[model samples]
Target: MDTTSNLEEAVEVLQQLGLKEYEARCFVGLSRLHSGTAKQLSEMTEVPRTRVYDAIRMLEAQGLVEIQHSSPQQFRAVPLEEATETLRDQYDARVERLHDALETVEIVDTDDESSVQQVWAMTGQDAIENRTNDLIREATDEIVLVVGDESLLTEDLIDTLNEVGNGVDLLIGALTETIQDRIRVAVPEATTFISGLEWLHGENATVDETAIGRLLLVDRSTILVSSIMPTTREERAVFGEGFGNGLVVIARRLMAQGLLTVRDPKQ
Candidate 1:
């Protein structure tokens, strides 16, 4: 790269490593020249001569540059590899300090009755998917899932359910034999049932004549219900957790009453 382009790139990288703009520019300029007086560095880069000494002092404190004792003090950048290693170590140390500081702060405990009973609404497909994945990952014993749209049964969701193994009870409405076959292949250990829920046949039916969206109950304590709008590419979901949450109770009862047992041939 040309001198200007090379300096620009180096300054960008150094700034990302937590150096100030002037410090980055000066250090890069000094690196290029091997050793240079502050005046020369300021002229080579965009740093003003007055600011060059301050930037060099900061770089020296960070162990990135060394100053030579002479009539006009010269600054030399540490070797590139050594500089990068020093930056990495400083970055890691800062991260460790931040982690320690965060641990010392008090956070509200949300596992109690009041917090768990609060229903939260989430919009957009990505947000709903992330919440669903979090529920799946946190499920300790059982997961009851009722899917209205086959498309909502993404590969990542299937993999997560498969990882949880036999504790998952899946009830999918209006699935064809082909789609059922795909689910079987994806999660071989889970009990997959076909639900004859009435919603699958009406005007409010999801795409492909399935039920309207999905209902997920994790360990019977957490519940999530989502509505899918295929034409508009919109998704809305509400979720809450608690032992006696009304949503969780209703969803569990609905799944038990509406779902029909489908015996897998292998089982």
Candidate 2:
């Protein structure tokens, strides 16, 4: 993208990672320079000159910026590689802390177990992917995944599939042979096949239709199916756990075609 857009995106990302606007702006400004005075950084980033020092100090404390001791203090972001690693470590630590804190927060128990199965709906690509990965990680017996769209075969999903413990079968189906080959190469242990689920990419499919994204069935009990909205391209999914769940039945019915047909292919 253009320089201005890149700078804005960088500032936005840094802010999301817990940096204040001024700190993020200052860091982005310094990232483009070897070293610069507060006034120069202010001019480049549009952060007030007086506030640049505050931002610089905060960034320095976070190990994102290095300040030179001089008459007019010079500031610069840490090397890109170093800065990235630092940010990753910080982000991971924060996530760990959040996990720990959340784990300790007692859940208020409501209703007891019911005969009815519950299906959960969730939005956003990252959250869906995380849920899929979590299901894969938790799989003890088998993982059956149908990739309706090739883009859903992300590196994180590949890694999770690869990490499935021994004796846990991994069956991955793709709508196209090319994606099957790609999956086989990336995950040698996985059984990859061309899915018989042609309706996922049927000729009748149009721009107005909600496109299938990914289908994941773990241990024959849990199921997650995501679809991409036609206009927004945003992914939304409904997941259910329990062998008796209607969604589980749907997952089995949806995946039976490919899995049942590929007995000799990868067996």
Candidate 3:
């Protein structure tokens, strides 16, 4: 006889897989015995014999149980790992098909002339940096950056930039001497520039006329920008990737209007 608590736990597992109470109990009884006739399972699990046959048939249809055409009929549970793997494979296939369909739809919609601004928020320094690094890896043409303060610079970000190869152009707005040293040491081949940061300083705005902000642009399309001071409070950043209101549009404007300065690659 199955213990009451073991029956309860078995019922819970079945329910988690979308089985009703009666069906769960019947399946649990069959699983515990390895293989049993419907009448026998009904007696052990306390399910009515009439309901037990139907539950076994339903479980067999779901590939969770197998049936034998012998006297009184028999049912057996599939091995747990095999059942789990089969369900997982089905779920993965469905997801892959859905993703493919979405990609095809996106290709058609991308042809339409439209502007969109989608905002994404991520908390914690590690998550923010990870998102930024992913954007960098996807950069095929260029990457832009603006820094409000140098304190946010870390070895991980610089290391990712260095390893990204020569396919991307790296641009920067304004950064401190120490931060510049870090970047130079990490990525000696990177092209960097400084301009338009004077807007940040109220009085010294004239001394250093540059923009004070942290904006990362990838592939002239995707952009990642942050406002939080990673040193003071729990920092957050936004990552936006698409055609409209992103690197493609904004970086073009910055380049055409001379709002940005490009560092000489030779130096």
Candidate 4:
């Protein structure tokens, strides 16, 4: 790229790094010249003479530039490597302070049972996956999962299941042997079972098939039912908690019935 293009790009980058537009332009101008008076910098960078002083003051405060107290007061950009290292150090220190502050902050306390009693609709694949992962990680006793779509079995979900300290029962349906193998390898502690019921009629069933969804019951208290949209292929989910919640009750009963159905065919 040409020198003008390089200067513009550098100014943009510096602005993103917390410098104002005038500061960025002034710094770039000074860096190219090694050192210059405010008037010279204003002319080279096209920054107004009035704003150049303000920008120079900011750069001096940030330790990115040095000022020589002469008749016209010359300004020099700090050595590039030193200026970058200073910015990195300041960034790291701020991040560390923020982390420490957050660690001490108390999260708002709410009654989990009452708070999650209402069914919440979650749209988008990322939202569904994140909510599911949160539910899985919060499970303390057991997790019952009914998987009807292999696409929903993400690596992060598998890792979360593997990390669960309690029991996990997985009922898988309509997945290829390879996908099933991947799940088994990732979540070795889970008791795997093949779901006998075929929610869809044939192998060519599309995502629109009502059967293309998954059920999750966490500690028999929280439940999430999710499906993949046929057209957009985006995932959607309804989740809720509370022992007496209607959705929770229905999910519990359905899971129980599924287990019994898998265990006994004559019934």
Best by lDDT: 2
lDDT of 4 by residue, 72-117 (tens): 9999999999989988887788889999999999989775556645
The TM-scores of all predictions, comma-separated, are 0.52, 0.88, 0.46, 0.53
Q: What is the C-alpha lDDT of each candidate?
A: 0.75, 0.87, 0.66, 0.76
Write down the TM-score for model 1: 0.52
Please provide, for model 3 over 26-98, each residue's C-alpha lDDT reduced to its tens digit, 9 standing for 90 to 100: 7778768878987788789899989887887777777888888989787888998876776577567878988
Candidate 1: where are CA atoms >4 Å away?
1-105, 108-113, 165-175, 200-211, 258-267
Error of 4 at 77 (Å): 19
Evaluated against the true structure, the overall lDDT of model 1 is 0.75
* Candidate that beats the other on TM-score, 1 or 4, i.e. the better one: 4
What ranking emerges by TM-score with the best candidate at the front? Answer: 2, 4, 1, 3
What is the per-residue lDDT of model 1 for residues 1-267, given as tens digits with 9 covering 90 to 100? 896787789889888889999999888888887799978888888689999999999999999999999989988999989988999999999999999999999998886557645889988877898889888888776676766677788988887777774555543333455656777777777666665555642455445432357788777688888886656757888898887677776766666644543422111
> Top model by TM-score, which number?
2
Model 3 TM-score, 2 decimals: 0.46
RMSD of 1: 8.6
